[model samples]
Target chain A: MEIITSSKAMQERALQLKKQGYSIGFAPTMGFLHEGHLKLVTQSLQENDVSVMSIFVNPLQFGPNEDFEAYPRDVERDKKLAENAGVNILFLPERTEIYPNEPSFEINVKNRTGVLCGRSRPGHFNGVATILIKLFNIILPDHVYFGMKDAQQVAVVDSLIKDFNFPIELIPVETEREEDGLARSSRNVYLSDEERSQAPHLYKGLQKGSEAIKKGEVNPSSVIHIIENYIKTNTNGKIDYIEILSFPNLDTLEQIHGKIIIALAVKFSKARLIDNIILEIHS
Target chain B: MEIITSSKAMQERALQLKKQGYSIGFAPTMGFLHEGHLKLVTQSLQENDVSVMSIFVNPLQFGPNEDFEAYPRDVERDKKLAENAGVNILFLPERTEIYPNEPSFEINVKNRTGVLCGRSRPGHFNGVATILIKLFNIILPDHVYFGMKDAQQVAVVDSLIKDFNFPIELIPVETEREEDGLARSSRNVYLSDEERSQAPHLYKGLQKGSEAIKKGEVNPSSVIHIIENYIKTNTNGKIDYIEILSFPNLDTLEQIHGKIIIALAVKFSKARLIDNIILEIHS
Candidate 1:
């Protein structure tokens, strides 16, 4: 695998590949690759002639109190995993390479927020949108992949691509879960042993929530209460929020009558984990 | 020339051409054809396999009191001129098409914006950056052209392209002038005959300021005073501002030592005119 550390070199390579008629599929990650991130890479490999993966732990996306400083980094392991997965280019740009100075311009995300994880982390999507713009311009991929475990991020990416007219297709892969149904995430490394044992209940709570919505319990508050009860009984982690809103748009529903998502965030001893399930509704 | 109003169709067409290994050169303008605008189109034609021109009088850039509604536009004349100059695509998207609704996202320009036209028109570069982000993504051009009549705009775009890592090359063409020294602008149409004659003095004043700096006068205020005095004496228009600042970065200089710009804006009775000259200063 070719490792690129310079933004200019990466862009030149992407542009050259583009001129030569090779389709590139990109998966951007924040190092510390897990099975879920590797899945995106493997899928991109299947879809395109060239598969490019980027690992930049962007500080722009993290809030003042969030995990910018403490975010996991195992670059050696990440590089080996990326090489084993057959990534054509593994972009590991230094912080200065990505942001030599404070950014002079920024993209403010104004939609598909106000619910779920977005509600808890202000400026999170804005930072994500900004970094993705820089990456999309640099990578110039034909298609980009995202794991639906970070479903709000996927929705933000959808809006960024559509609204800005980025000529790349988005491939949203389903969430990769553990045997006990815990959504796989790098932040999972921060979980204490006891918290790790209880983490599976977050997904189970979401499943119960989905099941209630699938059946006739239609009031959003009632459905939220059912899941809240499930997690409260099974786990010691604090529920940050459990919201039911229209899918992708994340708009509030008077009564759920279209595609909707039941999503939640829980703050355990040291890590915050989020998960969601999307379902379509019949009139 | 082929004209497209749909953003999606234009992107698809640009992408297809790109896949076929064609280089596209783009020039974005507000309508009202003139020799200056045609210069950009003809230059793009020379530089690339295809030339794409867009006429969008972006409302986002205009302040509430600025002349957005009254911005001069002549589609028929522009179409004929662009066709005569051999443009391959003329994208004329409606305001609603460019902005289907109030934008849920935006690019806020934080630098090179506290001087010249940017100082008077806040959020101007922000809007320009937002729209250009859309256009660059949609057109997928190899090179984009801009006239130096709006030098600050050229500077802003240069930063936008480099900072965002946009793959497109920016070709900053020298300001096209008439038999007289007046910078060609669509806004010149709003000038009364007297104002039309006085507008050339704006350029001439910038010339005098440059000549003084070419000699030993290195103080920014003195150079600005010289230009301001010339404009105040020669024209009926109100001298809005005349500033001498470091080039491109638009930073204030204690004493001009490197590349510098003598920029001015004059508000005529009915029209506002702007002009500038960039100079390389030693010691």
Candidate 2:
């Protein structure tokens, strides 16, 4: 596996591969590879002639108070895991290379970012959208993979590609979870042992929300109440928000109809974990 | 010449041409074609195997108080002008097509946009940056051409392409001038015959500033004063702004040591005119 560091070199490599008539698949990650991230790489490998995985711990995405300074990183371990997971090229750009100076131009995400994780962390989606667009321009992939664990992010990317006319396909893979239904994330490393045990309830709460919709709980408020109550009684974690909104668009619904997502963010002793489930209503 | 109205069709055409190893050169315009705009198209035709011109008339770049509704456009005449200039593809997308709805993501330009025309027209460059990025993604051009008449715009594009890692060359063509030394602009049509003659003074003033720099005037204030006085005396025009700053970065300079620009915008009774001259100061 080739490990490319410089943005210019990586861009040239992607361009060279493109000119050779190879369909490139890309998976952009923030280092600290887990089974969940590997799922995206697996999907990319299956879909394209070449798969490129980028492990850039972008500072732009983290708030001043957030885990930017303490974010986990293990490039040596990640390199081996990526190689085993079939990443043909592993781009690991340094902070200086990605941002020689403060970016003069920025991507301001408007819709689909006001709820869920977006409300908790302002400018987070803007940072994500900005870096992803830079990576898309550099890699010039035919298809880019994203784990649906970050559902709002996937929606933002969809809107970005469509609005800006980026000629790339978005492959949204389903969220990968643990045996206890805890959605795998790098931040899982921050959880204490006791906090880790309670983390599974976040996903379980989403499942209950989904089940509530399936059981003909047509009202969005009542459905949200059920899930909010589930998390409140079952876990010691503090509920940040429990929202039921239209998927992708993320507009508040008068009543649940068509496709909707039940998403939540819970803060345990050490880590904040988020999860969601999409439910489609058939007319 | 092929006229493409649909964004999808234009993207596909660009992709097809790129796959067939044709180098595409792009020129994005807002219709009402003039000699200055055609110069860019001519440069694109000379440089690349295929030349593409897009007449978008982007409303995003126009402020609420700006001349968005009153902005001149002539598609029929522009089509002929583009075809005559050897354009292989002319993309003319309607407002609804370019923007299916309000854009979910916006490109905000920060640097090189706080002076001169940018100060007078805020959010103007953001709109320009956004549409240009969309057009670049759609056209996938090897080279994109812009007129140096809008020197600050060329500077902003330089920073954008560098900051975003856009894999395309920016060809900044010199400003095209009339026999009377007036910079060619579609807005020149709004100028009365007297204003038309006086418009040439803007360029002449910039020329005087450039000559002062050549004559070893290291002081910015003195150089600006020379140009300002020249314009004030030579034409009955209202000075909007007269600034001497670092080239491209547009940063304020204490001492003139490196490459710099003396730029100004002057309003006549009927139209506003702008001009600038870049000078490299040798120690």
- Please give each candidate's TM-score: 0.98, 0.98
Q: Which segments of candidate 2 are over 4 A away from where they belong? A: none
Q: Is the docking of candidate 2 incorrect, acceptable, medium or high quality?
A: high
DockQ for each model: 0.82, 0.86
lDDT, candidates in the order shown: 0.90, 0.90
Candidate 1, residues B1-283: lDDT per residue as tens digits?
9999999899999999988989999999988978888899889989999999999999989988999999988899889999998989999998877888778788889889988888899888888988999999989899999998888999899988988889989998888888898988899999999888888999989999888988999888898888888888999989878988888888888998898888889999878888889889886
Tens-place lDDT per residue, model 2, B130-155, is 99889999999999999988899999
Model 2 chain B: lowest-lDDT 10 consecutive positions: B268-277
* DockQ-based CAPRI category assigned to the predicted complex of candidate 1: high
Model 1 CA deviation exceeding 4 Å by range: none
Residue B262 CA displacement from its true place in model 2, Å: 1.1
Best by DockQ: 2
